[model samples]
Target: MSNYSRFSRRRFLTTAAASGIGAVFLKGCLGNPPEPVGTAVTEQVEAAEISPEMMPETTKVVLGYIPIVEAAPLIVAKEKGFFAKYGMTDVEISKQANWASARDNVTIGSEGGGIDGGQWQMPMPHLISEGIITNGNKVPMYLLAQLITQGNGIAIAGKNQGKGLGLDISNAAEFVKNYAKTEGRKFKAAHTFPNVNQDFWIRYWFAAGGVDPDKDIDLLAVPPPETVQGMRNGTMDAFSTGDPWPYRIIAEDIGFMAALTAEIWKFHPEEYLAIRADWVDKNPKATKALLKGLMEAQQWIDGVNNTEAVVSIVAGRNYFNVPEDILVPPYKGDYKMGDGKAEIKDKMMGPLYWKDGIGNVSYPYKSHDLWFLTESMRWGFHKDAISDIDTAKQIIDRVNREDLWKEAATEAGFTADIPASTSRGVEKFFDGKTFDPQNPEAYLNSLEIKNV
Candidate 1:
């Protein structure tokens, strides 16, 4: 084990002893907390045990997710015997290096053999839609379930940090423009993928600030866990990632959170439980079973007490590999990135169980996909890629298996009355102007920067 891990374990035990609380990972430099005297079972453990027969009888299913708190439901389901209760034994969960690795694993494992499903950053399927990555290799992917919704925050380090640095201002939008002009330096922020929620959020936030992210910011693809290290290493000035990292940074007093993704747009969607097309084709029944398990886990995690258990479980070394204190939500109904400075909240980020199944695995809303595509194009990831809006929509439609999700959700007891058609809801950012998802042409046209 690395020095960090050793230190963390020692710290974890000490904290537990004093508070009688379960262990929580507190990465990004927490010293230590008083030890609790006794071990305590999280509320999740106490939830009435589920029987193995309650779930479908499926063989082993290999699952992949990045090491982040958003993937907690999967862990909870597995650890708490939800998977076993549902008749799924030999369920394997592995942490991939990054989003690209996770997506590739889904494609290859689904095609070659038994890689059941993989969790993906919310915008990845959309990227395949815009023909942004690996052309023709973009296999049709399906959304079995929506995992966690909003879970990211924008973190800014001190001025002593390297490139992409911006001043702290209450009005995040104005801060970007003035920082760009006065600093005469391109601001940098790390995100796990160029086509994910954080990617879209950074671009949208900048746009709202009157500074075009496409023109002003240099966004890089860095995995979530590595972001703070990047900031500490002076390779990045700020970064946007979900959970723990920002809170971890603040707990250690390394930096301040500039904004939360929910601030950019309340009810913003983030990650999903995505599977490659072929996998869905081969194991359709298994897919439904997996969705049921996930839905149950989602509902469990949403309970206030269960949320506390989630923080403890995901913080373990086997999962997120961070100290538990770092994973705790800093505020009630909100998240603080740095020292409780900035907070954002929305209904979407909350737990979403089967609203009676039909609404379970809904298709990716056009607006949600568009924002990421626009960001990829805006930030230069889509160079020479398909620029036509119609083509983008087709790509999105092919991969987003909302229909499949509906079936699974219905089976899981989720509501089936979700609007059959996608909505072109206006994209509201902190700056106030709305980007209409339905009117992509006009939205793109209105932008001051080059679309291509």
Candidate 2:
């Protein structure tokens, strides 16, 4: 924990965007069998060298993470000695002040006194691959894996007295759109960064209901950890982010969850494991080792009877800093909407983790990246260029390392059930919209409100 640093809301930088990422992992996997399970998250595993000569070149590696349950896999990997088991002896988990710091540090890389790899948004790696964002020293990044799927990622109608649920969101969009049209003003909403997955989720939902997110609403950048306080102080009307905050908002009675991103897109890929591309190119084996460890943690997190322990581990002061009780409900699949509505505990709404050692909720899918790139273009990210599928494919092909995760899963014994294809075909949204990865431009044209 020596790598940990204290964060302040005062240090947040603003940018906004995000996207659904990932395809799926194997049906079984491409391996033999996994090792036995450990009890505690901090329990160290007995070291077993993968090969007599294959040792990680870097003994210690620094990774940045926002202190949230979404970052659980990374923390769990370190705590459970998976990193050590996979040859990364000195894995340091550093705390970031906010998404801005995370983006900055990851961009700089360890060579520039920044992070080597960390849990990041799905769209960031795409931005990095396209050179829209870069290391302070100009190093690109690789999207190695999509760590987790969807869970309450988009919860609009959280502000402005909007009904927090149902198909009436069009009304709120109308209200905001009408406000913008008549009064020449915008309703303010909050997000963790200027452009993150949260922002895209917010924008997509608004656009689906006939509102132009860019013009009708003011999207404010509030750090995820502080978003609840921002809402409490009326700094924002609504916001969406990873766990604790969503449930925390409901618990605090400041707002209600409008729509869970899971409901929007049942299997929306939320976060990714990204690192400096140059470092990864130099240390592919080390990168694979880290992926192997994180995959192990992913299996543990979604295993049956493991939610409580995971909640406790991440809720620790060193992690999310939230109390255990607040995390229990979400871990248990009960999302209290806080609008006098019943708790939603559907498995899809819960953290999309590997349950009972079987599930592809965390695989880094090329199709997921493809969808994300399309959304990136729609929101004006390098809109003049790189919006087309060919450019997006080039960036994704260059950055997305689904093959690494597959190799890691195979080596880690997730075998006999590897996904036949890296693409998951066309995925449908709650609004009856479907994104066919092969034809992303069609999906882009299908949308009524977009940047281009």
Candidate 3:
């Protein structure tokens, strides 16, 4: 094991015990599974009590999160008293082992010792609603709000540094295509989960460069730690994952970032905050209360002044369990791309919660949901579930609940930030490909290397 990994594990065990945060073993993951940890809230802030009519049906909730930047808002809401301020005093932020564990846990819901809902990748709510990734048992869900934007990217192994593995790999596409012939194995790559945000990012990057992702490379889902170890041992060549991991690669000299999702599509939609529709329906007031808390946390984290505090709170052993320095660069938008690529130093390039270059990041824009489904179609993922554009639109309409986000924002006195439209309009990617929500079919047809 790498020294960093060993140190992190020791720190996790020591701090988790000292802090009195209950840590449970998580089964079924690569390597030894780290004990599942939850929020250890400190210093509760006093706020005005909710009116009798506005009081939530329930004050408690269990939300799942992976220890990544996308999960900052959820963790912050719990740690900084934002949830309690909004009348959600019993909120629990549970750490998930991996995306698959999250999926399985959510399948059983909170009553069954699982999460009610929490941070999620694009289209997962839709897929779970339609029973695509849920073992064919539909669990209706609502896409409440987007958790974050940017903070994700593609990483290339250090061994492949100078072979045209940057953002635009068109110049060395042949090098990637001929890996099997020369190296005696297919160029291996991985994402956190299949048919999700990370998977889509890598697929788009590969297809844009005239390299067929399916034919030219071996792409599969692997946990982030294993992915990093694979890169170190020269077993994995590339990875598409969220913040901290990508930065860890560069800090440990294991790999260099090929591109940020921010560069892939500036201020692009990343992960989301979604919940079971049954949960939302049963406790509408509580649902709004959760959104209000998340809104406060999101707005708080966006302030440049709070970067250090944000890093400190979320990097605790009970939370992300990563080194503070590893998170500092990405949170400050100070990425060192290595491999002769220019370094990026724009604050907006980091994870943004409430707003970004275009508009409100907290709003669950229906247009962004359309793009995920359209991209899924491009790769022919879950074709039986999302057979066509019309089917995808129906799913989006059912899953995305922008109206609830607006209600929560307005109630929280954030009326000014609510977007006027559900769509963010046409989005342009790094490779010059544009996805127009109005013409998703045209967008799909425009792709040169797709199963569809």
Q: Give each model's whole-structure lDDT.
A: 0.57, 0.68, 0.85
How well does candidate 2 match the true structure in TM-score terms? 0.85
Off by over 4 Å in 2: 1-42, 135-137, 155-159, 162-168, 179-185, 355-359
lDDT of 1 at 240: 76
Model 2 C-alpha lDDT per residue in residues 1-452, reported as the tens digit of each score: 11113211121110001111221111212121111112234344565445634455564677777766778888788766667676675676766666666666666566666678788877876676555765323447788777777755544444455343343377556666565565455666777765668888887777888777777778777765466666676555668677877777777777777767777777678888898888888887788889888878888888768888787767776666678998888766688776565678665567766531234766777898888778888888767547578988888788888888788778778875456788878888878888998788788888888877
Compute each candidate's TM-score over C-alphas. 0.75, 0.85, 0.93
- After superposition of all CA atoms, the RMSD between model 1 and the true structure is 10.2
Instruction: Score candidate 1 by lDDT.
Output: 0.57
- Looking at candidate 1, the ten consecutive residues that score lowest on lDDT are 28-37
For TM-score, the strongest prediction is: 3
lDDT of 1 by residue, 1-452 (tens): 44422223333233222212242322212122111111232332222222333333444577776667668777777666554443444456665656665555554553353244667776676554333554556656666556765567778765533333232233454555555586566667777776567776666655655666655667778865577776766556677777766677767666777766655665556677777666668766667667666767777776656656777767776677677666655323455544434454533443233231123323345556666665555545655554666666666676667666566556656654445666536766555556677776676666665445
lDDT of 3 by residue, 1-452 (tens): 54322223332233322233764535634333233355555544455356666677887787888889999999887777777676676777777777877777778888877878888998898999999988798999999989999999899999898898888889989999999898789999999989999999999999898889989899999988899999999999999999998888998999999999898889999999999999999998899989998998999999979999899989977787788999988999999998989999999998899889899999999999999999998898998888998998999999998999999888888999999999999999888889889998888888899998
Better of 2 and 3 by TM-score: 3
